[model samples]
Target: MKVTTTLIAAALACGASFAEAQAVQYAGGKTTFDGKCVVCHQAGGKGMDGLAPPLVEYPGKYAGTDEGRRHLGHTVLYGMFGPIKVKDKSYNFKMPSFASMSDAEIAEVLNYVVFDLNAQHGSAKPFDAEQIKALRASPVDGSAVHAQRESVVKSLGL
Candidate 1:
């Protein structure tokens, strides 16, 4: 009976640990990423070759600035097409929009990419739902987002 009780306690402890981990700061964003982004961005945001750009570096850099931050929101909501360069490599693909998702969800997913996946630790604030809502008011197609990339890149000096 004691052995069985100890095993149960161990299981309970592990369960609690898992729950705590899930409740971390970026948990909401991580959940959104796992569902929507992992397929393309892949695990740990490493991205795919000749396809999606690895998000690990740029996202962190983007979160630091206003234009870049806005670009992040636009990219997710509008998606992007055509060729883009990241880490000196070229990626040409069509990213699908997630416009149907709520503003809060988009913000959460961006936060996941910028802070959690990219590990951007600094004064850059977590994106708010209202900011995303504001961006949502002006909806554009993926091409527009792609076109806007040059300006944003210039602003970020990337």
Candidate 2:
């Protein structure tokens, strides 16, 4: 009984530590997001009315699949434009490209969106710099990214 109790306690402690470490990873992402993403996405990523789509829902869904994950990276690297719908709401704004940002920075920002804003802990996977870098090589325009998003959304079975 004592051994079992000790094991449980250790597991809890480890979990707490892992959570703390995970939070640390978001710090850089949060800073980058605040400086660049906050004006459109708002403080909590609730998004603006008739303007930007909320980051809270789709990002978690996007993190679930390989294509979805690739779409996330392409969105940042290429910047999506034209009309797009989120949660039955139509938004037709042009999101500018952030291709100048390094791979690590982009990954961190996406990590912020996927994990912190979306509250997708344990349900979605975190992004790494390598993933974004891989998408960087094959450059495409914002229109392509938007098209990719369309296909990815459908592929998600939504």
Give the 10-residue window scoring lowest on summed lDDT in candidate 1. 115-124
The most accurate candidate by TM-score is 1
CA-lDDT, candidates in order = 0.86, 0.86
Provide the RMSD of all predictions against the true structure, rounded to 1 decimal: 3.7, 7.8
Candidate 2's displacement at residue 157, Å, is 2.8
Candidate 1 per-residue C-alpha lDDT over 1-158 given as tens digits, one digit per residue, 9 for 90 to 100: 99999999999999998986864577888888889988998987998999988988887887788878888999999898999998689999899998888999999988878877776546678998999999989888888888888788777788
TM-score of each: 0.83, 0.81
Pairs in steric clash, model 2: none
